[model samples]
Target: MLQNFLVPDVLTHNYLVNGFCKSGDLETAKWIIIDMLCRGPSPNCATYNTLMVGYCASNDLDKALDLLSTMSTCAIRPNRVTCNILVHALCNKGLLGEATKLLGEILEDKPESKTANLITSTILMNGYFKNGDISSALAIWEEISKGHRTRDVVAYNVMIHGAGLSLHHSLAYRFVCEMYKKGLMPDVFTYNALLSLLFKEKKTTEACYIHGVMSKMGVPPNIISYRVLIQGLCINGDVDLAKEYLHIMLEDSVLPDIYIWNSLIDGYGRHGDVQQAFYIRDQMVASGIFPNIFTYNALINAIAREGKLVEAHNLKTEMIFHGVYPDVVTYNILIGAACRLRHVHIGLLLHDEMLKKGCHPDIITYTQLLKGFCLIGKVINAEILFDQMISSGLMIDHVPFQIIIKKHWRMGELDKAFENYQIWLRRDK
Candidate 1:
């Protein structure tokens, strides 16, 4: 196409650049933009805005800012769209201060750009919520309510989800009620967000009440709603009620996904009911639902907790046979189990397996292994692993370092213990 055309129009260039950006080929997109500029086709506000949006979408904030500056130099004034894109990118990166500053500048320039106002306000409010500044979020909400005649459902949903994540479930419920007063019906997302909070707080009775209210209001419960409710019940150790909900979901023809099964299995495992948990797993397999990593982890950890090493080891073998590769969490559980059973050789073997699978052990994994070594009086091995962790660029935080230091101290290795203490102090400073 380029060979036939002596020069491409600005619209054609904009379209191609946007296509590249959307496909995440930012370098190619930039090349196309440069080609357009070299061809002497004057770039307009829309062209600059499109490029800025692309940069923001790609999370190239620095490049986006540079483009913003270039836009001004090119004498193509940025539109509301451009400002909103920048604000959104800043918020997404957790640069709330910068986002707020850009927003202030935009509002100061054009107080009546309601489109920019709405978009920026939503981004800023969400950023505040994410930063755990509920006071700031509420203030922004009040500002929006005062300015706009009607708030969008998205704004309300963000507030609800943010509140829930922050453990202010009651405030989230109040937002729902407020939405009701404004004649804005709660959608599936709204219910899901509130239900997730209820579950997080273990407010089973309130969750059930919400379920009833949802049914009474003729709001159809989606798969997410059911999943959240079931998971919540499971997390609260109400496995019987979780099972009841599972049955209800099956009867309602809402297919139980892997996550739901994992939650149920994890719940049962937490309650030390390995048999019931395996029963659920069997049902899952019978229903043709393939078990994922979480499934195997739950079962392995549960059986290991019961001192059923043979059964747990068999499950690990079955997991590999099924091609569901274990993750770091799985290795941690296996190592912990082996440690509890005094099977140091087996634990070390699992550690080697983790390395063979190219799965790097995280701090928790190392911590568990360290405890295992300490328990078995293998201080030298623990020290070696600790050094390996540091050499691998893992941060030697105070807790784990202190644990190793104390262990060495107890063993009368004063020099090594003091050296570790000095390292911790240096890092702390």
Candidate 2:
């Protein structure tokens, strides 16, 4: 344990940096690296890479990139791992140009990194797709395929998944066939991508067919696979089929997570099946998956729409009892319902409670409350609320003006009503 007798290895020092960075202690992580430089166990590429990753994780990407200069000062050349990490972080931040430039610099410095280039290219392609530049992503794919490097399933997956997300059916299918032609087997990701695309296209028949194909081809669907299947089906208004897939998922030994349950509950609620929504909530709890705010929101929305305000209020109270405190969405739904029913006092109380709980009210929240107060002839309260909305810098259209003018007109204040009418007319124009 004597520091002088046995200095920590480079791996141990890197671990300390990783631990500190993960805990949001970048200062300590940097101090550890400085200590290594001042004392023994000279830092290596991995050590600086660890520190760079920490900087990136902490959102100080400039400092992370600066570590490259420090690495050079220490006479350590940054390797492909370092390049890939920075490239990935850059892509995630939507800095595609910067990422591309950095990748070029790395490849120019060391041109023998075929495998590393392929992986980084996939990340860049994905980044392009996310930024909605499908052509750029395809251009990246073309480069990879044209190169001598053998295209792996992962590269193909990135292309196919990108195409799927962008709803490019032709590209997704073309990639699937290309994978086969190149003698690369499609993994679970490949099929999942296809299924997702089919759902977006509303080709439910093809999606189901692909699910069957996955089973026959022995590409076992993971939790994400089933989730996409059920979620897409539920979204396309096939809650019944989605429920069937849930049973199939359990049979496949994939435990349904909270997301899956919430999707099903929301789907049934949307389908106007209040009892079924609650039934799903109970089943979710019975499976040892606690119902989250989303679960209760769907349930509350379903019944609240049916004029069952009491039941909806009780459910809101129950959310707190179960430790799922009401969020902005929760209050919004209740407040909107109360306004609809002309129960403006209930909406007011909910608004106050929302603020006390530190849930910031959005424009929708302010708009709803403003309409409620105006409807109940509380013009002073309505005006005060409107000032608060303007102070909050909320952007909205003429809807607020429409409410103000109508309220003033009903109160027989034609001059005030006419003034707002002019402003609304000019603003709308």
For all predictions, the C-alpha RMSD in Å is 5.1, 3.7
lDDT tens digits, residues 1-429, model 2?
Answer: 355687788889899988998998989989998998898688889889988988888788899889988898889998888888898889889999999998787657746668988888888888898888999988877787687777799989988988877878798899899889989988998888888888888988789889988878989888988888899999999998999999898887889999999999999988899888888888888989998888899888888888789999999899899899888988898998898888988998988988898998888888898998887778999988876765676776777877888898888999999987886676567
| Candidate 2 Cα misplacement greater than 4 A, ranges | 1-32, 366-392, 397-429
Give residue 392's error in model 2 in angstroms: 5.9
Best by lDDT: 2
lDDT of 1 at 19: 87
Extract clashing residue pairs from model 1: none
lDDT of 2: 0.87
For each of the candidates, give the backbone clash count: 0, 0
Give residue 317's lDDT in candidate 2 (0 to 100): 91
Clashes of 2: 0
What is the per-residue lDDT of model 1 for residues 299-391, given as tens digits with 9 covering 90 to 100? 998888888888887888899999988899888888888887778788888889899989987887777778778878988888898888778
Model 2, TM vs. native: 0.85
Worst 10 residues of 2 by lDDT: 387-396
Please list the C-alpha lDDT of all candidates, in the order they appear: 0.84, 0.87
